[model samples]
Target: MSKVTQHEATGLDDLDPATAPARDAVHFRRIVAARQQVSDAEDGLREAVQAAREAGDSWTIIGAAMDTTRQAAHERFGRAR
Candidate 1:
């Protein structure tokens, strides 16, 4: 079975598991690990945004911290707060 690099596999659907059981196992494991990392980061961001709101930080400040517009930050994380 051939190994699929990041450029080769556009997504998990391109991971032909049946043809490469061992490699697929490793790829699937790594995919889960990467996904967990992303999920954790997202949760952390949400928590931080909520905390900032509770601390009276305006959307403008949060937006600057996120390198985005004030409206964008408020639109994305305000509801969570």
Candidate 2:
């Protein structure tokens, strides 16, 4: 497929306001859905981390994999401790 320039891609340079609204509605729905997915993923990760900590995994191991310090992990997810 060919790449579109910014104006061509958005159609903002030519399209009528009425036409833009419908297209914008679809974009808005996608934005909302993407945000929802991010929130869901965060919740899932929180649950998984809690479960792992509860299972007796060391904070050092978890923090290293998370690219954070053990103290930071405890501060963030220590409720499971």
Candidate 3:
């Protein structure tokens, strides 16, 4: 696979970074906030997985819900409980 440059990802090949320091800063801040939100969501997902296990849900069902394989789900979250 080839690398996708920031301009490619954002479809802004003409974007001028030097002239957009404030906009870049805002984008960086938003990225940080989004990462934190993802972390929180992951924690919630782990808790939900544990709760589901406690409720007699099998790894297969959990995996199906998560769009993953049973082994993958078990490997990732089985130890949470």
Candidate 4:
């Protein structure tokens, strides 16, 4: 997936007052959709991590799969269950 820069996400560049309200509405919808997607993804990740732990996977292994430190992963998702 391509990365969206801050400028692209904010929709603030070259905004004119005449059409700003319409443009801002579109931007607000995009932000809301993005936030929902992120929330869904986090829920899935938590479920996957819980499954992996139940299947005898260690925090180190799970963290490696997530490309993060073991402590970080545990701290974030340990109480998820």
Candidate 3 structure lDDT: 0.89
State the weakest 10-residue window (summed lDDT) of model 1: 15-24
- TM-scores, all models, native as reference: 0.69, 0.62, 0.68, 0.68
Q: Per the 3 Å backbone cut-off, how many clashing residue pairs does candidate 1 have? A: 0
Superposed Cα deviation of residue 52, candidate 4 (Å): 0.4
User: Which lDDT tens digits does candidate 1 get at residues 1-81?
Assistant: 999886567675665768856544688689989999999999999999999999999999999999999999999987734
Clashes of 4: 0
Cα displacement (angstroms), candidate 1, residue 48, comes to 0.2
Q: How displaced is residue 29 in candidate 2, in Å?
A: 1.0
Pairs in steric clash, model 3: none
Compared with the true structure, what per-residue lDDT tens digits does model 4 show for residues 7-75? Answer: 778777667878766634788789989999999999899999999999999999999999999999999
List where candidate 3 sits over 4 angstroms from the true fold.
Answer: 1-24
Model 3, range 18-51, lDDT digits (tens) per residue?
8765444788789979999999999999999999
Task: List clashing residue pairs in candidate 2.
Answer: none
Q: Tens digits of per-residue lDDT for model 2 on 1-81? A: 898897897666897877556544788689979999999998887887787888989989878878999988878888643
Residue 59 in candidate 2, Cα distance off native in Å: 1.2
Q: Which of the two, 1 or 2, has more TM-score?
A: 1
Question: lDDT for every model?
Answer: 0.87, 0.82, 0.89, 0.89
